[model samples]
Target chain A: MDIPTFDDVLAAQDRIGPHVHRTPVLTNGQLGDLAGASLFFKCENFQKVGAFKARGACNAVFSLTDEEAKRGVATHSSGNHGQAIAYAAGRRGIHSTIVMPKTAAKPKFDGVRGYGGEVVTCPPGTRSREEAVAAVLERTGANFIHPFDDAHVIAGQGTCGLELLQDAGHLDAIVAPVGGGGLISGTCLAASGFSPATKVYAAEPEQADDACRSKRAGHIVEDDAPQTIADGLKASLKPLTFHFVANHVSEVLTVSEKEIVDAMRLVWERMKIVIEPSSAVAVAAVLKNRELFAGQRVGIILTGGNVDLDRLPWAG
Target chain B: MDIPTFDDVLAAQDRIGPHVHRTPVLTNGQLGDLAGASLFFKCENFQKVGAFKARGACNAVFSLTDEEAKRGVATHSSGNHGQAIAYAAGRRGIHSTIVMPKTAAKPKFDGVRGYGGEVVTCPPGTRSREEAVAAVLERTGANFIHPFDDAHVIAGQGTCGLELLQDAGHLDAIVAPVGGGGLISGTCLAASGFSPATKVYAAEPEQADDACRSKRAGHIVEDDAPQTIADGLKASLKPLTFHFVANHVSEVLTVSEKEIVDAMRLVWERMKIVIEPSSAVAVAAVLKNRELFAGQRVGIILTGGNVDLDRLPWAG
Candidate 1:
């Protein structure tokens, strides 16, 4: 298994610069005052494919050989990563096949289709999705673009932190959502490489806090079946991701679903920016642990915004 | 009263450069396909007051004499301009007395108060709001800042256009929401000043299109008791605003409340940005007038995002 370094992320930035948006950094004076922290939100919700997943997806897709690219790419994702792979492949005029759980939101399925990718439905649960994706790989000989756990993917995702540091200049600490830990590992690598003075942290939802548990126990841990409004942050950490997170990250914070919802509402209401629960987890951590970050310039990565409008957590 | 021209708008860029955000020009392929035009949205929904009104209000507040600013500023508005004036004045440690219609959205009133502004609520009518504002002005000797029809306000509003043109370069036409013609007039002056070739237009809801009526009639026109989801655009044209509109604007287009709501929904659904109905009016115009703008870069100013979240049109 390969491990990505700062040089790989630097190369990925050059590769992906023309494709992705350098999303705006939005500041909220009210939220800053209330939380007792000066925050910088690298709004990856505005990134291509409406998430940070685009960075990983694009890197994996574009790194392939001409013959490999011709065969097409395959991935299994419940939501954001599926759409991301679809969007990245489509932009390069390459074919993409996504194996999605049937229980996934209709909007995610639509997003994959909108990006000109083929969708294969599987029954709900990890085993079924894995089986379906495996069957597709055997049948079509398509390259498996793992959502995380891949060195190329992590290096690709690292560009987001590279951008935050590039834009904000100096930061005391960095916080990001911990799903499968691709974003967090990438963030750790980027932060450690560029500025050793900055400490990296992971934010996770309590219901689906496998990453926090894994870090605390100093081993990979899986939830007893994941659950959270932050569907993008529901996945457990993998070996490579766990290695980076355990070594580089300083701490992990947990936020309740109510706190996540309140954070989402505040971003939508006060900042007029749309952010999903996964993104809100980072904000929730900032608001909840204000004492830890008071007067410090904290950089937060907004993970995604591919949410179902009708199923908004705050809505009745 | 002194009049503003393209020259004044150019100068406003130098004046308010440090104060306001040069908000991003946002576009997505999905949103572009729906409107049948190449749309570059100047996201003033991300502005200081959550709208372009912050530009004008800040300009007006800053233009006041030292003695006048010490006495504070007073205005009568039930929407974005009221909040803009309040927020802008608060930055300068200047007091603000905002007279708003009692029927205004609770969020708007709360926003004004949240900015350290004094709020005086009157009955839901022009006469009552005017009387209340006059009382405040007389009592405090505060500087009277008209929401529109003021040279400084219009010049401030023009700054939004200046930032747009700087980022987007040359554009075919610019469409902005019209509420007492403040943003539109400022946009017109800015557009003409920078690129004399770009046409400037105004968008309004059909129910309260006093500017559209005034454009055609060559005089100020009242709404005769207005009704529209675009609460920010309910104001009738004033003499100074009418004069600027008559001389500079290319045309005024009107859309139904349903169209405004539909456009607002698309922006939220596709762009993942929360925009108020007034901002949607400009988008609605581009969607309504596709033939004229197709294959051309149309600049649309998303004027505000101060909509009542509890009473969102989509929720209703």
Candidate 2:
């Protein structure tokens, strides 16, 4: 697998620029007071498909050759990536197929179908999901776009950090939640090219700390069905994401499930924005380790806002 | 009571400009598609104290004479107005007293106390609340700032519409939820000054349709503790607000309780922002009266984002 470079990110920025929102960087003085840091929130919650996944999916879908594009794209995701692929493919006027577990939320399926994607449901399990995607590719001759492992996807996600640097200059550090590591990996490469002195950090859930373990062991680490409230961060780091983490990331901070929920509630109550638990992980890390960021300028990426409103983590 | 004019609005704009946020006007294509009209949402939900009440309260607090300022400010309320008064008074480093019913939520008291305001508890009747405020005023010599009936507050709330017109130019119509009619009344004056061609419409809950009845009857219509999910819209319109509604407002649109909840959920789900039920009343009005606003550009003021997260109307 090829590792994505800053130049690839620049190219991806141009490719996906028109498709994604240059989301605002919001700051709250009250929240700042609590964290004891000047925090700039890169609000990808307001991005296309309500997540940063749109950038990667758009770049991947549009990067295909005309011959390859004619066959369309396929992906297996039960979350934002599925909707992103469908949305991006719709933008290019091409068909996209999303493979998901049959147990995926009704809204997730609706989200994919809303963007004109064909949904293929598989039985629960990673093997079943992969087999379903393989079957779709075999039957439709569509190109497979891995959610995070692909170079194009990482490069595409890098555009978020590039835009963040452009919008909020001279950040002492940048923190992004590490799930499959696509966003944080891209952020690390962006920081390297755009602002070399800006430290890049990843916030991971302590309940599912494979990425943190992988960093310490200097290799890929897998979690066997690790459970956490941050459903998006369940996936462990893959080889491509692990490469960027090993080379560029400064630290992998782990936060408790309670901390994540508390951070999520604070953002909602104070900043008046809906953010998923994955996004709160980064905030939780910053707040939990106030000494590390005290009086410093930090940028925290709010990766997405696609939450089930009826089932918020803080609510009964 | 003196009727506030466009000049007062302009003056209030300058007075409160330094204190309140010139909040962003957000648009979601999906929401526009649903409404069958291009919608520009003036997001006062992001304003200080999480409501446009900050605008009115700040203006009232700052408009006082030096002698009046020394006496400080006082208001009787159990919601956003209480917090707004506290916040505005704190900005000037002056004392503020917020009188509330003993049954008011604990968070409401905390919000006032958070801003260093004294919270005076009164029994649950209007007479008791008024008497409590009277006692506070007699003891502290604090200037009374009526939530909506005051000219400075009306002028202050008008600034929201002025900013809306400046941001979203040439709106065919503007909709605001009518509580005591401060927001919509001010919006009417703003439309008259900034964009005379733009009609102003008020959205009222069906349960608390006093404002709607008042508009039709050409006089004030009071509801005796009318109940709705939109807790912010329970107050009846006063003489000053009635003056603006009778002379300037084009129509008063009422929506069902279920419609407001649906609109609130839709905004949270699609626009990825937190909005209280009062804000949703305006969106619900535009959605329910589709033919009235179809193919037109409409501006809707999202009045606030203060809600009990644990007890969402849609949740069981």
Candidate 3:
């Protein structure tokens, strides 16, 4: 199916309202001065399971009928999406399994288990995990829940933009970090529906700016080895998500790794919020392309806050 | 001067509304599971100057007339309050002089300067910093802004509770870490005014539970040997604050150093907030006494987030 429409996102908001958090919107005056804009931070870092993934997870799980959910669910993600789907599935009292890279964060690995998902580890950077999850789903008759590519997931992710508009009201633009394009696709639908005057923009890490290049050239582009601190945005955009993003997102911007680190530090030091590098991508883009957002009220979605602090950039 | 009453706190809230943050509140189902209670965290860690100290600082600065502010504002603090008063005074175009212990965190020292304050460094002792500040105030005719002793400071501190109750609504109890008793005194007054059924409790480190002992004995007590991971709660309470706390607060609970560290880690890991040891005191209290708060809605004041990441427990 094509990407969910604005009507679909509104329906997703209704479907996911009971599951996800209505995370707070925050503003820091001192930080605002540095941005040279009135910035409202929609703190998805405080979202359930500590990222915007919960929106997609809830939409995917709830989209299933009781019989379909009873067949169980499964997914492959070493990060936020794994825990999100696990947490969402657990809430429905359904059996769920997550295929994760063996080298995933210990906290995240434990988080999925803590939320009652059966965890299966696979070799990192291999199709082994995906194949293993597909085998498990077939063997157990469990449904394979896509991390971001699924229509339900995009619709679910859109609920974040819906909530942002509900809380912060109108914004000149909404800037979101683009991964598989799930969040931005959802954000676009919501912004288009609620604040039709608002523009939707995507922030991609420079190392993983294939999505930006692809969007400009009107074709899919392979990742440039995908080496970025923003592990969440490393995924190649799916065709369905790319279609929505290409049609709806006003612009896609990129920022360097150094900018991501600096933005992460500023958020930790000034905003007192601990966000992962993936989350910092949005802030990095704002800072890198300051002219585009300066003097315009913008909503910057701080995506996640699950970074390992023991080796956080500021620690050294 | 006496400790400010609820009426006084409400007045201060009105006075300082323009200067201070009605700091956002947050919650997570994951973090609540650890404490075995639903929690509402008033994130004063996001307050101006990175702590609840901003409330009192703004109140103290604005309470002064034009002539009084022209003379300058002076205070002695380990860190947060000093930065707060500095920021507040700077907002009014007044000079600020902060006498801090030489051992205070480097970020805090930078914050004072960053906000345009003169720093007077003294040896690591309350006596040394107090003596240096007193001498400086006498010599320069700067107003001595007592960090948590003066009624205006306490009234200003109470504004945090005012903000908490506004959003957190009715709760079984509100928990805060007590040091000089300024934050707790204000919290108690606000709690009493907003929800008469709700109780106010103070969380203090067992190593420096002078406030707890004082509450039990109905008298102010100074600790000659104070030690705690929560450095912000190591000070002795003054007479005025002691009296208000004795009358308003329901109980003073103490937590072990290990619990403080564990709570700080839990907040950082689960709640996704960069809370300091001092702010962790209340979380420690809740986890330590789960039965008292379990199944009941509880509000916790996350007082600050200024700990050096380099010195984070996981790193060192």
- Specify the highest-DockQ model's number: 2
Over the stretch B1-316, how does candidate 2's per-residue lDDT look in tens digits? 6888899999999999999999999999999999999999999999999999999999999999877899999999999999999999999989999999999999999999999999999999999988898999999999999999998999999999999999998999999999998898889989999899999999999999998899899899899999999999999999989988888889999999999999999999888899999999999999999999999999999999999998899988
- TM-scores for all candidates? 0.96, 0.99, 0.93
lDDT of 1 by residue, B85-152 (tens): 89888988999999988887788788899888999999977678778888898899999888888999
Each model's lDDT comes to: 0.87, 0.94, 0.86
In model 3, what is the error at residue B5, expressed in angstroms?
A: 2.7
What is the lDDT, from 0 to 100, of the residue B286 in candidate 1? 90
lDDT of 2 by residue, A1-316 (tens): 8988999999999999889999999988998999999999999999999999999999999999999999999999989999999999999999999999999999999999999999999999999998898899999999999999999999999999999998998999999999999998899989999999999999999999999999999998899899999988999899899988888898899999999999999999899999999999999999998999999999999999999877888776
Q: Write the per-residue lDDT of candidate 3 for residues A171-228, one digit (tens) a residue.
A: 9988899988899989988988889999998999888997898898898786855888
Which candidate gets the maximum lDDT versus the true structure? Answer: 2
Interface RMSD, candidates in the order listed: 1.3, 0.8, 1.4
Worst 10 residues of 2 chain A by lDDT: A307-316
lDDT of 3 at A11: 86
Better of 1 and 2 by lDDT: 2
Ranking by lDDT: 2, 1, 3
Rank list by TM-score: 2, 1, 3
Report how far residue A214 has shifted in candidate 3, in Å.
2.1
